[model samples]
Target: MKSKLNLGLLLVAFVCVLACGPKKENNETETADTTAVSNEPKEFGEADGKKVSLYTLKNSHGVEAHITNYGGIITSLMVPDKTGKLEDVVLGYDNLADYQKDSPYFGALIGRYGNRIAKGKFTLDGEEYTLAVNNGVNTLHGGKKGFDKVVWDAEKITTDEGEGLKLNYVSPDMEEGYPGELKVEVTYVLTDDNSLKIDYTATTDKKTIVNLTNHSYFNLTGGVKGDILGHEVMINADKFVPIDSTLIPEGQLESVDGTPFDFREPTAIGARIGEDNQQLTYGGGYDHCWVLNADGEGMTKAASVYEPKSGRLMEIFTTEPGLQFYSGNFLDGSLTGKGGVAYKYRWGIALETEHYPDSPNQPDFPSVELNPGETYHTSTTYKFSTK
Candidate 1:
């Protein structure tokens, strides 16, 4: 009888062990499967009369970036630091509705004319042309409907430069009343060296003004939590184009000396933003154009920004003559961003590579006229690295 009791107790202990361990393991397995299912990507909408899909590019070091064919916008850029934590370094929206309706031109390709046109009028080779006036008494960013909204004809291309994707769009004559059928092609090339090269090309059927640029708001602090107040910025410029109260250029190239426009050395963006300066008040922040110190030859370094916290650094190289350093002053707490984060004022920073603002109206400014038999070509690159 004692032997029988000993065997029964042993069996009960075995059963207890199974009940305690395997059952807990089953629960853990179920919870892990639930988490795995939740992390899968959800389906999104279509674009451009084709199978609009999102493409993800990853480097050998596991840095990933997502690009969608819709407007050729960059959805997100994930970079892994020395600690093996990946972060979305660029600002973007969550769904298609936010991007379609109230986008702040985030990660978009702005073209035809990147900035504004005074009075919606300009004289090209002594011929007057009137463009679409969408802003108050002026035209901003190509018009009410610009290239940023249109889905470009895209193609994945390979180049010795790097793995690249090319997008094409044809702006028909009088589409927005600029006077030319412009065929434009923009190439976003990702290099193995962590640089995003944007090359633009265009040809017009008639005489038209053209200036293209990319609007990518960057927050090197992983696009979360930290303001850019601590980031150091420098622009290779000695003179800047100041604007009036309407944020339109007043046809004068002002010196950066003794002004907040000077960025020869690294300075915080908010250092001179609140100063009692006329240009600051007119811009509501730093929205003016800086005449880049280029040799009038090829692509050169225009600007550089370094975020000490994340150790992510961005260098802007472009063939354009000017750069627009926008502090995102108008980004009020109205637009909900990715993961329902409210993008408050100055949430991101835009370093627009283009000609000066209102260059079409300013006679002394660089010519933006694109006529027949002449191709409009411009290139800008944003190279990223961690210090």
Candidate 2:
């Protein structure tokens, strides 16, 4: 009778295991799912009396990132180099106050209009609006208080591809002299493929202009440690916009043939930056925008940068029509950054993907106008790898 009871109990236990799996296994799976879902952002700072948060994203390959709601800035991006070592490749301040106080837009999101608008004025729909001139005689990066200076609302987002943050902000009408009540949504995703993708969408109640781009000063050899002069660059552009003495576009898409601006091949950034060119003289370095060579942009290769020492390669793929390659000529070692490092001139580079600068003033360039009922959307990805 005892043997019969033991056999019946063993059968019941086998049936339960088959039906419900193992309790330990179920608990382990639940714990993993909970950990991923509960990845909360920490309180970073306060801006305009609103709370600002910073999100930390990581991939299975150990690539980690820290982004803040204030300016949607990427404070740190650590990726593995050829030596299988991780390094922070972007330059940024350690605190929010440094960004607020006369920053160079390091790792921030530029928007409303990413570039200049010529003399701080533009006529849209027969109404001329004058904007605040911050960059000499032009309205730069959506005027004085651009999107880079504002605090946005951010939430963690996950997809089958990877993890990211969805940021939302509504720019009031004429917040920076732009003409609309613009609702903007930006998503920054760190994919498993070691790429950072930025997706932007916006809609305006009234007709307004929008040109958004991330301004990340990448050194590749790690941020602010050395100049990017040794980095090799290739731009998929046959033509580039020539800037005036004040660094505003001269309204011409000049051919890059036989000029230092030509980067059809992988060329060192400092190769011809000091060549006797008038355009180079005006900007003090490679600060102009190049018109991307695309058949009809779905997503095309805009540019690629490679650092030899670290063997870090970054390829820029975007739906935008232009690439602004700023060689960090304006960074003058005036301030200290993360770990008390002073950022000097040409220590970093920005390959900002966007529409042409001063597009409103130049009718020949691509349109940036987002009217009512029209959704403005664009995407840019920076793929990193060791070559």
Candidate 3:
């Protein structure tokens, strides 16, 4: 009977081991799933008394985008290079405090009128409205507190193509001197094809001007250790909007032919950036808007950048009419970015797709007026590939 009892005890122990072994296997599978595609958001910090979270979105191709809802900012984007090695292709801070303290927009979303309005003044419906002037002599990027500064409500979504983060924010009437109760929804999707697609939709209760865009500073080299001067750029634009000394558009579109602004062909950013051009001097570098050539009205190829060393290529497609290519001219090594790297001049570049700058003030430009019954919608995609 004692032998029989020992046999039964051994069987029970074996059963327990079998049970625990599957649990470990299950845990391993869960970890693999999380690494492949995860929607779980970790607490980033508190912003404006509200809890902020950081979301990790990974695609089938292992492209990961870490986005925080504080400013709907993409803190880091890991993309694969020519060697199938992944690296962060965007510039941003490692922590929330750094971003909140000071940021050059980084990977945040811009809204309520991107670029600038001349002198922060725009007359809508015969009523002159004055906005908070942040840039010199103009209201830039939605003025003092643009969408980049506000916290947005975020929701994890599963798109048919890949993972998505849907962000929503409401701008009250007369907020930032804008005349509207604007409700904005922006969705960011990381596709399996290695594309970061942004979809924007907004509606307002009152007539207000609206222009939204993402301001992600990109360095195809995968980090801020080097500058983007060697990257070849090709903008599908025949005309470009020349800016004044204040960096506001001159309200007239000029042909890029025979000018340094000509990027109809693949050209290095530093090739003509130092040419004796007044526009270059005014903006300190290439901070002008290019008039994108359209082939219908839907999304068209706006611009492309290729880094030969890494064999990384990024193609921009947008439904907007204009594309602002701003070389990182403002960075002066005053701020330290990810990995304790100092952000220097021309370390990164911004390719912002939107309507023309100061659109509300420029009647000749595209109208940015959003009526109560009309809906504002735009989409931009930055597709990445290797040579």
Candidate 4:
């Protein structure tokens, strides 16, 4: 009887071990030496007669992000809240066709020139070039068929930094009225430290201009939540570019001192957003670019956001010289996003890191010109946490 009991006890113990043992095999490579690529990639949709794919990128932490090769867009980003509950923070549509349709940039990658160029025209090397006038008189986000509207070649990548996807696209000479055959590669990595890192690289055969950035509208409390005006925002910028009637920079920087543009201190986005100010009136809200005050360059902290209710915090660090803090002023009630939620005005906010808008036209600004021999490289990381 005692021998039989011992055998039964051993069997029960073995069952428990099988059920509760560590799940390390799924996330095996925790160190730098091994490749830890996440599995499970699916076909997203077809675009321009090509099959697009969505890749799942997971860190050792519970964080996961879904990115599709079409436009190199992030379909969803799941991160943990203060209570250890994972939730999607970035805003987008549930359908792939909606993304390819009338939606805003959402989680798409912006490029060639991320922000606006003055009057859809610029004189590069004393040669004037004309581009598609999409946004009023200026060219916004690369033009009508910008980098955000095309397909990219994506491959699973695992570096010492983290596991993610490497998306490559080659822009033919003057594809969007921009010169040079631009070969570009962008890598999206979700590190174990609860951060999403974006590495951008490009090389041009001829002299061309480039300012690449990701346009992910974030709402820390989740996309389906209400307006983000209650969220606290702090940007390390002492100066901001003022806009004109058409939302193009006037080629000047104004001190943020004593103005609503001052985000030097953590303040509610709506605290002074409605102030009777000229800049606010011109932008219809906070839509202009702010010159960031970084400590001697090379990926310094640019901005940080905190959602009081969810206790979610996101910190932005980048090598770019300027940050565009848009308050989603144009998100009217005309469309619905993920989970059938209407995206109203001020529903999301974008903290886009890049060179100053119209950098090619503003000679005083940091040059966006990429010559044949020069390589264009920049990176930005968004770190998340909970208080």
Clashes of each: 0, 0, 0, 0
- Candidate 4 residue lDDT tens string, 1-387: 999999999999998887666555434445423443337568788999998888988888879999999888987999888898899999898878999878689999997889999888888788998988898889999999999999999999888878889999999999889999999999999999999999999999999899999999999996558899999999999999988888888888999999999999999999999999988998889998999998885888999999998999999999999999999999997888889888899989999999999888888898899999989999999999999
lDDT of 1 by residue, 60-166 (tens): 56666666666778888887544557788778987666788889788888877898898888877787888889878988889878888887766666688666677
> What Cα-based lDDT does every candidate model obtain?
0.83, 0.91, 0.93, 0.90
Best-to-worst order by TM-score is 3, 2, 4, 1
* Model 4 lDDT-worst window of ten: 29-38
What's the TM-score of each model vs. the native? 0.86, 0.90, 0.95, 0.90
Cα lDDT, model 4, residue 211: 96
Instruction: For candidate 4, report its TM-score.
Output: 0.90
lDDT for model 3: 0.93
lDDT of 2 at 287: 91
Query: How well is each residue in 15-133 modelled by candidate 3, as lDDT tens digits?
Result: 99999999999999999998656467988889899999999888988899999998899999999889998999999998999998989999999988889889999998899998999
Instruction: Summarize candidate 2's per-residue lDDT along 283-358 as a digit string, tens digits.
Output: 8899999999986849999999999999999999999999999998888888688888988888989999999999
In model 4, residue pairs whose N, Cα or C atoms come closer than 3 Å (at least 3 residues apart or on different chains), thus clashing, are none
Which sections of candidate 3 miss by over 4 Å? Answer: 1-38
Which is better, 2 or 4, measured by lDDT? 2
Alpha-carbon runs more than 4 Å astray in model 2: 1-38
